[model samples]
Target: MTATNVETTRVVRTSWLPLIVVVLTQIQASFAVNALTVSMAGITTDLDTPATSVGTAITAGTFGMAAFILLGAKIGSRFGTRGVFQIAVVIHGLAMLGVALSVSPTMLFIAQASSGAVIALIAPALTVFIATNYHGEQQGKAIGLLAAAIPAAGVLALLLAGWFANTIGWRWSFVLMVGLALINLLLSFRLKRVPAQPGLSIDWAGAILAAIAVILLSFGFSGLATWGVVLATPQAPFEVLGISPAPILIIAGLIVGQAFFMWLRRRAHEGLPRIFDLRVLATGSERAVTACMATMLFVGTAANFLIPLYIQVVQGRSSIETSFAIIPYTLSIFLSSTFVAYLYGRFAPRVLATAGFVVVASALTLLAFTVRGEWSQAFVVAGLILLGLGQGAIVALVFNTLLSAAPKQLAGDVGAWRGLVHNLSGSVGIAVASAFAVGILASSIATSAAEHPEISDELIAQVNLDEVNFITNEALAELLATRASGPELDAAIAVNAEARLHALKISLLSLAAISLLAIVPATRMPRQRAGDLPEKLEPDDDDLIDPVDEQEALG
Candidate 1:
C-alpha cells in the first residue's frame, strides 16, 4: 500500500479500544495536577506548610512541562515512540507515588516536576499516535475526544480528590493517581508502536537555551509579588541597578528566548538537527490556532487558580468544598468541549472562536460584578457555567484545527508547540492573577481605610500595608488584635473584606477585557463557511492525500 493509503486506512484496520486508551493519557495528566491544587488546604495542614506554598508545586509542574516538552518530542522520534511513551507512563506513576508519600513540600515539588517532564513526551505522542492510528473522520473524532479529556479529567479529579482528601487526608489523592496510571499502562498495551528512528539527532544546545529561557521567565513571573514587580522588595535577595531580580530575570529570559529562536533558524539553515522543527509554526492557521490556545488557556488557568484559592483561603474550606464549588464549571466545560467537535464541519473556526470569546468576556463580567467576600448568587454559578462552556469550545476547536491543519510528520512538533503554549500560559496566568489581585487588595485597603472614620490614618500608617497578603478572616482578626481593638478593629475588618472583594472584581474585569481583545485574533482564524476546512488542512486530509512533494516535505 502507498504511504498515503496506509495513513488513511490505519484506523479502519484497528480495534476501537486503542482510541479510548490514547485519551486516558490526557485524563491522567490533568487529573493529577487538578487533584493537587484542590487539595491545597489538606497539603498545607498535613505538611505544616503555608497555603501559599501550593502555588510553588503547581508552577514547578508547569515549568517541568515547558522546559522538557520539545526535548520529549525529540526523544519520542529517536526511541520507539510507544516504548518511550510507556516508560514515561510508568515513571510518572512512580512520581505520583512519591507525591502520595511526600514528607515535605520539597518532595512534593520534586515528584510533580518529574511527572510533568515525562508527560511532556506522552502528550505529543498521544496526538501523533492518534493521527498515525486513525484516519479520515475517525481522526477528527479522536482529536475531539483528546480535547474533551481535559475537562473530563477535571470532573473526575474534583469528584475523587474531594472525597478522598476529605476522608483520608490529601496524601491518598495522589496515591489514587498511581492506580489510574497503572490502569493506563495496562490499556496502553493495546496500542502499537512505530519503528525507532535511531538516526535522528537532537539539538542539545537549543534545548538547553529554551529550557533556561522558559524556566527563568516562569520563575520571575511567579515571584513578581514576593520579589517586587520593578523595585527591590525586602524578600528579594539582590538588586540589579536598584531593580528587583525578578524583572531582570524576565528580561534576561526574553533575550535568551529570542536567541533560542535565532539558533533554531540557524540550525535549520545549516541543515543540522533541531530540537523543534519550526515549519509547523510558519503558517497563518497554525499561528492562529496557537494564539487561540494560549489566550484561552491563560484565562482558564487564572480562574482555576483563583477559585480554589478563594474557597480554601477565604472560606477556610477543604478539598471537598473546593470541588463542589467548581462542579458546575467543570461539567459545563465537558459538555462544551465535546459538543464543539460536532460543529467543526458546521461553522467556520473564526465564527466559533469569536462567539466563544464573546461568551467568555460576558461571563467574566458577570462574575466580576457578582463576586464578593460573602457573595453567593445563582447568577454567579450561571456565569461560571458560561465561562466553562465558552472556554471549552474554543479549546476544542482551536486544537482540532491545529491537529488537522499541520502535516502528519510534524504532528509531534505541533504537539510540542501546544504543550509549550499551554503550560507557559498557565504559569503566566496564575502569576498575573496573583500579583494583580494582591496589589489591588493592598491599595484598595489603604484607600478604603482612609474614608472610614473608625480606621484612623495613624492606624493605617502603623500597619505595613504593602506587605499584607490575603489570608483568612480568622488570621486577619488575630493579626488585627496585635495592632488595634474594639470598633476600630471591626471597622478595619469590614474595610479589608470589602477591599478584597473589589480586588477580585477588578482582576476578573481585567481578564474579561483580555478575553474581549482575544476576539481580534479569533477573528483571524481561517474564514471558511459551514463544512469548509482551513486551506492548510488539505495537505494532511486523510481522505484526499495528494502525495505532492510539499505534503511529503514537512517532517
Candidate 2:
C-alpha cells in the first residue's frame, strides 16, 4: 500500500478518545505543579522551611523537565510511543506518591523532580499521538484542547488542592494525583499506537551538555535572592573570588548553552543525528513564535507565582482564599484557550498575538497601579481577568502556529521544543520574580527604617537587614516585639507593609515592560491566518511508510 493510502486509513480510524487521554495526561502533569503552588504555606509550616524552599521545589520540577525533554523526544522515537507513555504514566504516579510521603524539603524536591523527568516522556508522545491519529481540523481542535489543559489543570488544582490543604492536609493533593494517574494509565489503552523508529540513534553527548546548562541556569537564578544578585552574601554557600556564585553560574550556563548549539550545528553539517532539529526554528516567523511563547510564559508564570506569594505568604491568608481570589483568571484562560481557534480564520496570527500582548501589558499595568494589600478589589479582579484572557489567547495562538509550521515527522521535536521553553521559561520566571521582589523588599525596608525616627540605627544593626525576605505582618511584629515597643514597633510594621506593596508594584511593572517587548516579536510573526496556510509536508512524505504497511513489508 502507498503511504498516502496508509495515512488515509489511519485518519479514518481516529477517535476522540485519544485526545481525551492526552488532555488528561497534560492535566495530571500540570496539577502536580499547581498543587505545589497552592500548598506552599502548608508545606513551609509543616517542613519548618521558608516559602522560598517550596518555590525551589517547584523550580526543580520544571528544571528537570527542561533539562531532559529533548532527549525524551528521541527516546520516544527509539522506543514505541505507546509503551514509553504508559511506563511514564506509572512512574509519574509513583513520583506523586513519593511527594505525598515526603518528610523534608529535600524529599519534596526529589519527588517533584522525578515527576517532572517522567513528564518529559509523556509530553512529546502526546503530540506524536495526535499527529498519527488525527488530521486537519480534528488535529487543530486536539491541539487547542491540549493547550487548554494547563489552565484547566490550574483551576482544578486551585479548588481541589485548596480544599484539601485547608481541611484534610496538603499531602492529600498529591495523593489525589496518584489516583488520577492510575485512571489516565487505564485510559491509555484506547489511544492509537504509533510505530517507533528503531534506526534513530541517541545523542548522549548533546544531552549531557543541554542538561548541565539548564541545571546551572535554574540553580543560579533561584539562588540570586539568597546569594546576593551581584556580590557575595553570608547566605551564599561559597564565593568565587569574592563574587557571588549565582552570576558566575549564569555565565557558565550561557557558555555551555552556546556550546550545545554549536555541537548541534556541527552534527547537522555532518548529517548526523542531532538532539533536536534546527529546522523547527529555521524561519524568522518560527523564531518569532518561540520568542513570543517564551515571553508570555515568563510574564504569566511570574504573575502567577507573585500573586500566591502575596496572598498566602505575605497576607497570611488560607489556601481556600487564594483559590477563590484567582478564579476569574484561571477561568478566563480556559475559555480563551478553548475558543481561540474560531478567531484564527478571522484574524492573522500577528494581529491576534499583538493584541494579546497589548492586553496583557495593559492588565499588568492596571494591576501595578491598583493593587494595594487587598485581594478583593474590583480592579484587581479585572486585571486578573484581562491578564488571563491575553495570556491564554497568545499561548494557544503560538502553539497552533508552531505546530502548523512543521511537518508531521518532526512532531516529536516540536513538542520537545515547546515543552522545553514552556517549563524553562516558567521556572526562570518564578525564580526571577522571587529574587526581584525579595531584593526590592530588602532595600526598601532598610531605606524606610533609616528614615523612621523610632527605628534607631542600633535596632537596624541588631537585625540582619541583608537577610530580609517576605514575611507576614504578624511574623514581623513577633520578631520585633522583644526589641521594639510602642512607636518603634508601629514604625517597623509600617515599613514592612509599605515595602511589601512597593516590591509587588515594581515586579508587576517590570513584567508589564516585558509584555510590551514581546509585542516586537509578535510583529515578526506570520501575517497570514494559520488556517489559511497550507500544511507543510516532509520531502519524503510519498516514500514514507506507515506502521501497518511496514509490518506488512516485514511479513
Candidate 3:
C-alpha cells in the first residue's frame, strides 16, 4: 500500500455506533447467565424441580458454548462475521422465547442448551469485530467498554429479574433477553463485513475430541454439589472403589483433555487442518492473558453464586432481596471497569494483574472472616468494592493485550479461545464452590452431632447428612418437624445454623487461596506498559489458500 492510502485509512474515524452494538452482544450474554442465578428459586418452584436441576440449566449452557465455540470461529471464517452474527442474533431471540415459554424441566434444558449453542456463533463475532474495526487507543477503549459492559449488564439483569420474578414472573426475565437480541440484530445491519473464506475447512476430528473433554469436565464439576466429590453418595448410580463417581468423571475429562492436545499436535505434524492455532498462544504475553482471564472468572463466578445463595437459601429471602444484596458488588464492578482501562497507559500488565489478584484475595479473606449467620451488609459492601476495583482493571488489561498483540486475521481464533476459557472456568468455579460449601456443611453437622448428645446420632441419622445438601434453615426445620421434637430437635437446628455459617466461611477461604495462587502466573505477564507499541502479527495473504482442495495449505 502507498503512503497516501495508508494516510487515508488512518484518518478515517471509526463509528461509535458499531462498538455500541458489539458491546450489546457482550452485555446480553452475561445478563442471561446472571439472571438465571437470581431466578433459580422461582424457576425451580414453578417447574416443580429440585434446585440442583435449575442450576444444571446454567451448566448446560456453558457446556454447549464450550463445545461449539471453536467451531463457531471456523463457521465465522467461512461465512463472514457479519452474516453469522446477524443470523445468530435471530436464532438467539427465538431460543430466548423458548426459554421464557418452557413448561417443564425438560423444555427448559432444551431451550437453555439451544440458546447457548446460538450464543457461541455470536460471542466470537463481537470480539473479532472490535479487534478488526478499531486500533491503537480506540481499540483499547473499546475492549475496556466491552469488559465493563459484562458486569454492567449483570447488574441490570439482576435488578430486572428480581423485579420481574417478584411481580410478573421469572419467565419475563428471559423475555427481556429476546428483546435485547432483536434490537442488536437490527443494529448489526450497519456493521462492516469481511469477505468470506469460501474454501475454509472444519477440523471435525479435533473439534469432537475437544468438545467431549470440555463437556465431561463441565458435567463433573456441575455435579460436585449433587454427587459426592470423593466418596460415593446416594445420588451416584455406581461407585469406583467406593469413591464418588463425580471425581471419576473429572479424572476422565483430564485424560480426554490431554488427548485433545495430542491430537492437535499429530494433526499439525501430519499436515492436517489445525482446529486451534498454536501460534495464537506462542508468546508468554498471550498465555498470561489466558491465565488472568481464568483466575478472575473463577473468583468472580464463585462470589456471584455465593451471594444469591446466602440471601435466598440461608436467609430465606426472596429473589428481590438477593438482587438488593448484590447491588454494591455489581455496582462496584461496573463503575471500576469504566475507569480501569485508563490505567493501562501507566502500569505494566505484571504489576496491574498481580495487584488485581491481591485485591481479590484480600477481599475474599475479609468476607470469610466477617460473614456470620446474621451478616452485616456494610462489611460485605466494603469487601465488594475492593474486589471490583481489582477485577475490573485486570479484565481490561488482559483483553487489550491480546487484541494489540495479534493481527486482524486471527481475531476469530482469539474470540474462540476467550469463549472457551470463560465458559470452562465459570462452570468449574460455580460447581466447586457449591461442592465445597455443601461438603463443609455436612461434615460440620456430623462433627457437632457426634460431640453433642442433645443432637443425638439417631437424630443425625434421620437426615441424609452423608449427601451433598445446601438447604435453608426453614427447610431444615420442616424436615425435622416430622422426625423429632423437644430440646433435642431445637439443639439439632442450632447445630445446622452453625454448620451453614461455618461452611460458607471455609469455602470462601478456599477461593481466596486459589486467587492468591494466581499471583504466581500473573508475575510472568509482560512487563510492557499498555502505551507501548505491541509486536503485531502480520496478516497472511488471504488469496494464497483456497478451501476447495485438501492439498491447499494455510501459510
Candidate 4:
C-alpha cells in the first residue's frame, strides 16, 4: 500500500472510536453531577438542615472539584489516562453510595467532596483523550456535544429526581447513581489507554500552596457572610484556619503560591511538574477562555438560582409548580446548546457569545420591569426561555474556544484548568449574586423600618428578610394584616415592592456586567472552521501509556 493510504487508514481507526467514548463519558459524568441538584430540597428536609447549610454542602463540591483538578492531572501524568480514569470511576461510585447511606449531614458533605474530586479526575482525562484522538472540526463537535450533554443530563435529572423524591426519597435518588456509575464503568472498558509525557514529577510545594489558596479562596467566596461577619464584627460567625475576613491574607497566600510555583517551574529541569502551570495564564488565549467560561456561568447561575425563589415566594407557587415554571430554562438550554454549537463551528465564538449575552441582558431588563407581586406564567416562561437560549449559546461558544485555544501536549492540564475556571466561576457568580441580593434586602428593610416607626426593632430583627423575599409574599401579607388602615397597608406594599425590585435588578444587572466581561477575551479567539481536521487513526500512539499496557501490547 502507498504510505498515504496506510496513514489514512490508521487515522480513521484512531479518531472515531476514542471520540465516541470521550463524548459519551462526558455526558454520563455530567448527568451524574447535575442529578444531585434535583433532590437538594429533599435532602435538606431529610437531614433537617437549613437551606444555607445545604447550599454550603453543594458549594463544597465545587471547592473540592477546583482544588483537586490539578491533582487529577498529575495523576493522569503519572499513572496514564486509563488508570486514573478507572480509579476515578470507582471512587465516584463509592462516593455516591456513601452519600446515599449517610445519616449525618457531615458524612454526606464529605461524600460530596470526594465525588467532586473524582469528577475533576474523570473530566480532565476524558478531555485529554479526546484532544489527542480528534482534530479540527471533529474536536469542536466533540466538545460541543459534551456541552450539550450538561443540559440533557439536567433534563433527565430533574425529571427522575422529582419522580423519585415523590415516590421513594432523596436518599434513594442518590442511591440510583450507583447503577449509572456501574454502567459508565462497563462502557469505560472500551476506552484506550493514553500515554503520559515523561519526566513529569508532581510539584509537591506548588500543589500544596495551590490547593491551600484554592480552598481558602473558594471557602471565602462560599462563606462570604462568614468572612464579612468576621470583618464587620470581630465576634461574628465561625472562622476557618484562624482566618476570617482573611481576604487580604488569602490574596497574599495566592501571590506567594504563584511565586513559589513559578520558581519551581524555573527549576523544573531538576524535576518538578508545576501543577498549576502559571505560564498558561500569561497567554491571551487561555485568559480569554477562562474569562468566557466564568462570564457564562455568572449569567446562567444568577438567572437559574433566582427564578425558582421568585416563583415560589413572590408568586406563591408550590414546589412542583416552581419546577414546572423553570422548565423553559432547562428545555431551552438543551435545544439551544445543540443548535448554537453548530453555529459556533461556522462563525467566530465571539459573535455567538456577544449576541447571546445581549439577549440575556435584554431578558433580564424585561424581567426586572415585569417581575411583580403578581406574575403570569407566560411572563415567567418567556424570561426563562430567553435566559436559557442565551446561556446555551454562551456555554457552546466558551467550550469551543477553550478547546481550540488549548495545545495538544498540555491538553489534560489545560482541561483541568478549564474545569477549575468553570466551577470557580459558578461558585463566585452565585456568591456574588446572593451577596448583592442580601445587601439590597437589608438596605430596603432598614429604609422600610425607618419610615414605619410603629414597627418595632425586635420585629424587624426577627424577620428573615432573605428567606421571606425569596418565599411567597404571603409572609409579607401576614405582616400587613397587622395594620388596619388603607394608608398603612399601602406603605407596607410600597416598601415590599421596592425591596424586591431592587434585589432583582441588582442581581440581573450585575450578571449583565459580568457577561460583558467575556466579550473582550472572546475576541482573541481565531475564527476557525469546526471539524476542519480529519479524525485520527491512532490517537493513543503518541500519548503516554501505562507501563503495564505498553509491555502487554508489545508482547
lDDT of 3 at 54: 64
Native-vs-model 4 lDDT? 0.64
Per-model lDDT: 0.79, 0.85, 0.76, 0.64
Residue 149 error for model 3, in Å?
Answer: 1.4
Q: Please give me the total number of clashing residue pairs in predicted model 4.
A: 16
Worst 10 residues of 1 by lDDT: 532-541
Root-mean-square deviation of candidate 3 = 5.2
| Best of the two (2, 4) by lDDT | 2
List the RMSD of every prediction in angstroms.
Answer: 4.8, 5.7, 5.2, 7.1
Q: Candidates' TM-scores? A: 0.90, 0.93, 0.90, 0.81
lDDT (C-alpha) at residue 94 in model 1: 93
Clash tally for model 1 = 0
Worst 10 residues of 3 by lDDT: 546-555
lDDT by residue for model 4 (368-431), tens: 7667655464675687788888888777776655544443344455567778877766766666
The parts of candidate 4 lying over 4 Å away from their true place are: 1-28, 31-36, 102-105, 132-138, 195-199, 226-253, 260-272, 276-279, 312-319, 373-376, 461-502, 529-555
lDDT of 2 by residue, 456-548 (tens): 887899888668888888888888888998999899999999999999999999999999999988987754323322222111212231221
The candidate with the higher TM-score, 1 or 2, is 2
The clash count of every prediction, one per candidate, is: 0, 0, 1, 16
Best to worst by lDDT, what's the order?
2, 1, 3, 4
How many clashes in candidate 3? 1
For model 2 the TM-score comes to 0.93
